[model samples]
Target chain A: MPTIIFNRPDNRSERVDASAGDSVMQVATTHGVDEIVAECGGNAMCATCHVYVDEGWIARLAPMSEEEDELLHGVAAERLPNSRLSCQIKITPELDGLVVRLPDRQI
Target chain B: MSASGFTPSAGVPHMDIDPFSIEFFEDPHPAHEVLREAGPVVWFDKWKVYGVARHAEVHAVLNDPLTFCSSRGVGLSDFAKEKAWRPQSIILEADPPEHARTRAVLSRVLSPTVMKQLRGSFVAAAESRVEALLAKGSFDAIADLAEAYPLSVFPDALGLKPEGRENLLPYASLVFNSFGPPNQLRQDAIERSAPHQAYVAEQCQRENLAPGGFGDCIHARADAGDITAAEAPLLVRSLLSAGLDTTVNGIGAAVYCLARFPDQWARLRSDPTLARNAFEEAVRFESPVQTFFRTTTRDVEISGSRIGEGEKILMFLAAANRDPRRWDRPDEYDVTRKTSGHVGYGSGIHMCVGQLVARLEGEAVLSALAKRVSAIEITGPATRRFNNTLRGLESLPVSIKAA
Candidate 1:
């Protein structure tokens, strides 16, 4: 099983066994990792599931679409080049050891 | 409409009119067309808010919260200035840092996986309800089916007791009503719900919520300090505020469309898969949550209107949904219409969290109806419910022929 780690400011950490085809958001949500919202249910309409992909992992994830980019503008946290809507990024076999940080807010 | 006369600081489109009056509320399409045609940005004078009526502009405003902040609050009355009768919601009101934590907890608990697990139960409930109504032949769609379905499943899923759940509609109505002008509609709902606020708050306590439900998960997050315990029920209120009336309105609208357009109903009956699309198209035709307010964070220009920082902006979602510029033959109800990107469930960060639940409930009810009812025809005039934000029917008498 692939593993993904979540970084929270309070030093809270969660490790989820990412299902082969699950997005990081899906894996986090299914396993009770309470650090992601994904309020739009992975529709790429809401930025509630926003996360900052580490530089190394960014190259592995698919590029963002117009909808995802548009939604990112609404998120509360500071948007960075590495920031991506987790719903838009699916976990593949290639992303075996991914690490992502949760934003302070999804709004 | 001189380009030089347009000030970037006053992005006020020319057609800032009151949308809540009887004439506009009864039929806002003509005014909406004027607003859209006048400019992309329109100001609502009575509410003292600027707004976007054009489809593309509405989507743009909804998608850009940084420029249009929700941190102040969604309602017309600023909670920060007023002593809000109830606690504020972490997910609904707060900006990023605070908003993120609550959303995380809610998302984790109400994940699609969990929803899939509950699908069978929801479908069963929907089927049984539809079957019961179909057997009756003639029934009010709002009271009988649309309101009944979510009023049953959503509250039960929250572990709200029989008595506690009674506050669902009134509480939600006031919550949404308060988002509009502070008139009789707002006052009436608030006064009715004021007494129950304490009880509503108490329900969020750990002891009140039964285990293995979304409400309990909210409390669990409260314990984790992701959200305050006080905020739990209020967040739960967001579910209630958003869940019941919207879904009820949505289902009512869909059923109304089916009755008004028999061809669409026939298509849904033959092709059961069209049920989902049918519901969405109905939502497009009549947006349930008609409008929501957002505040401008900085000076912004849209459609030759310049809105200054901290100004209120009320985006007319229903108007935008019928934007002639965006959709051809915008008034007609056609299930086959390309209605994919409509603002029926809103857009961007503040978009509805329970939309999946709404969609699933709709599909379930429509699918069940398709199974049992060979045909449905309207027998009486459907009365529109008087709600500031919710566009729904109060009664829709329909005769259904059981298959």
Candidate 2:
């Protein structure tokens, strides 16, 4: 199991133990974490599961797909360099100590 | 004149099919094949609009709203030039910046927290409906199960008055039909839809909506300056126009699927938690929202063809869902397949806002059935309900054995 820290919109930091193959969005949704919406249910279609990776953890993640990049442009919040769609980020062992901050809102 | 004020590109492959015709509506798969094989962007000579049927092209057009705008209207008639059938949806028809404001407010109003609160009542309603249907054993799945469950629970959740609640279905039908050319279907729908449309408009008013319902919450947002007070009713109207029919068809699709594939039903019965995935797979297999229009903002090239600005491009969402280029076995209804990327809920900024609600309803009904029903078998041939855009069965005769 990989431990991921979710920095919620309400400023609460909750640590979740996630399975290696599950996406961060899946873990958050299954664990009842309020920060991620996952509106499209892990499809790279909706930008509702947006998260900002901490600077230190950004290098370990996979590259964004064209679909993910296009959807990110539609996010309600401003898209920062670290902004990523949580649905596209699979929880691998290398990402065991990932830290992601949820956007205030995801439409 | 091209609605976008540009000249039409010459030599685009022409197909003289009326996508809204009774024939096409009854069995659209053949027509869908024609659209896909014709070209990436073919000209519908009958409707004089460009049509895109391939999955990749449809996805591209939906993703690029700046080049293919929704502000003109997501239907055959461009709102910029023609008088709208009703007030335009501030959320659906508007582009970003303007669209962002209303969407943000609505997203919060329909957030997961709110939906979670609705789960208990919705699930109870589903269980009760399933209980009743199982007792009858052999019944019309559409009328007795699909339509009944949504009518029983959704309107009450919206805080609508019980008296004229039947109007929502016809109103939604009219709205969807208006997206196609003004054919006989559109004409008939328009005539029969007036009373229902009037009733929906009346219910959208602030005083008419029940306190503490979704409608009331939208009005409260207006008071807080999230959206204008004038826009509140229209947003409520948006919910009324879209919410019910999609879910009804979705549930209908689920039952139709399980009855058609007995083994899948058995799989669901063994693991009732697969209920949500079952509904989603059905959506992918039988896309309820078949098509929507997008207009070109400027000349853009897609699939080796240059499309001129202001052209009405009809994106076949259902066709795209089944396009071979996308899925391994696009037509199969496999509940375990990862169906996340399907356009059953249209992609991009204008994706269906009520999808979560629809999924919740489907999950509730299917979960109840899986827990209580051991098997679902089709007792008779399912009859199709022909709408211009939605694909659903009017009656599904199913016999279920109680677990």
Candidate 3:
């Protein structure tokens, strides 16, 4: 199975196995990754499942859409250039070992 | 609307009991278990509508909003066939694709981010309320903490003029009860809340709300062309309509659960982070917003029983939460239980739009009390306030022991 790494604000990290077809949000929620509150169930209706993609993997992932861009502005944390809604990032085999930082608080 | 021409299949169980009766509301558990065991679809002869009590059926029905539409109204009175008592809720009574647009703007406006911003004020209010209750020594949880906490904070969050803050519960009573059969409960609530409806309508206007509050954020969406300006105020109405009494009842239910189940209280006391989950469990256990109606867009079959087109199916969310088929210990009040799939918040796209708000409010209050108070002892009876659609207490006299 492909895997992803979730780094928390406190400098701790969890490397978890991810299913090939699942979104990063799905993996985060399934593994009970803390503060990954996909409140609107990943409709992009809520921007709670925000993550800061590790720089090296940013270009390797799918580009953000207009909806994701607009929702990013509404996130509680300071939105960075690498900020992405995890629900919009679908996991692919090539994206294994992808790293994303969880926001300190989602709500 | 009456299901006069329609009929249910012989496979569906028939019930003669009134689900709206005060007697049923007072002790609904036995009836709920019977409804769940009866069949997937049970026809309540009193209302002449089908009832879906099992978790699977309720989940499936709510998920397939396309087939079981809300456009006809989410109440016994069908909007398609008869005039509604109020302008049908643009959000609650609406279905996609329009429902999608309105829901998007709403979910955006009241997202977790907004709750983050409101967290400071909400927690402060919760802490202050706890202090007041402690000073009083003994008080009704309903009047003092449950109702008082939300009433103090939510109106300020909405930025409504403080004078008519009292109108929220009456208006909410009218909105929720209107979903049921227009019996004495519905009629009485409607009569008493007429002026209150007018009062709330005025508050929904953009000019009446303070800038940078929940109403303002929604209206900002209108300016950006996400939703119509006309739809903005009504959407704000949606928040007030669903947000108030449901939350008040939710808090009351949590306090009642902790008081009755000492072990659970101890569990919550040991770890304050479980406060949110405790509130969620209480909501699952109590099922505050008891039921909703979904008019069938087409003939539907669930588990083997058939329900016809234009028929009303009362989705018993409370009953579904307790269905033994769903939870490991459906009757037990355990704060640590995983309550993710519970229908207490409803299900599918129309799931409670205000859930994030409810969670924030529930957590703030629960965390505050769990930290300051050691025991929540029931000193007097916890009286059930009967409404056609809501399950809550009118009074819960309790004295707390300081930690």
Tens-digit per-residue lDDT, B1-403, candidate 1: 2112233244355454677765677877788788888777765546666667888998988888788767777766555456655566667777765666666666556654566677899989998998888768888888888888988798878777777666777767777787877777878887787655666666666677778878888877788887776767767766656777788889988988888888888888888866766887888898888888777667778766666776777788998889888788988887656454688887767677777677778888888888889988889988878877888888998888888
Question: How large is the interface RMSD of candidate 2?
Answer: 6.9
Candidate 2 runs further than 4 Å off: A1-85, A88-107, B1-11
**lDDT assessment of candidate 2:** 0.85
Worst 10 residues of 2 chain B by lDDT: B1-10
Q: B66, model 1: CA deviation in Å?
A: 1.7
List candidate 1 stretches off by more than 4 Å. Answer: A1-107, B1-11, B79-85, B223-225, B228-230
Best by lDDT: 3
> How displaced is residue B303 in candidate 2, in Å?
2.0
Instruction: Tell me each candidate's TM-score.
Output: 0.78, 0.83, 0.88
Encode model 3's per-residue lDDT on B19-138: one tens digit a residue.
999889989999999999988889988888899999999999999998999999999998888998878778888898889889888877776567778889899999989988888889
| Runs in model 3 lying further than 4 Å from the true structure | A1-107, B1-3
TM accuracy, model 3: 0.88
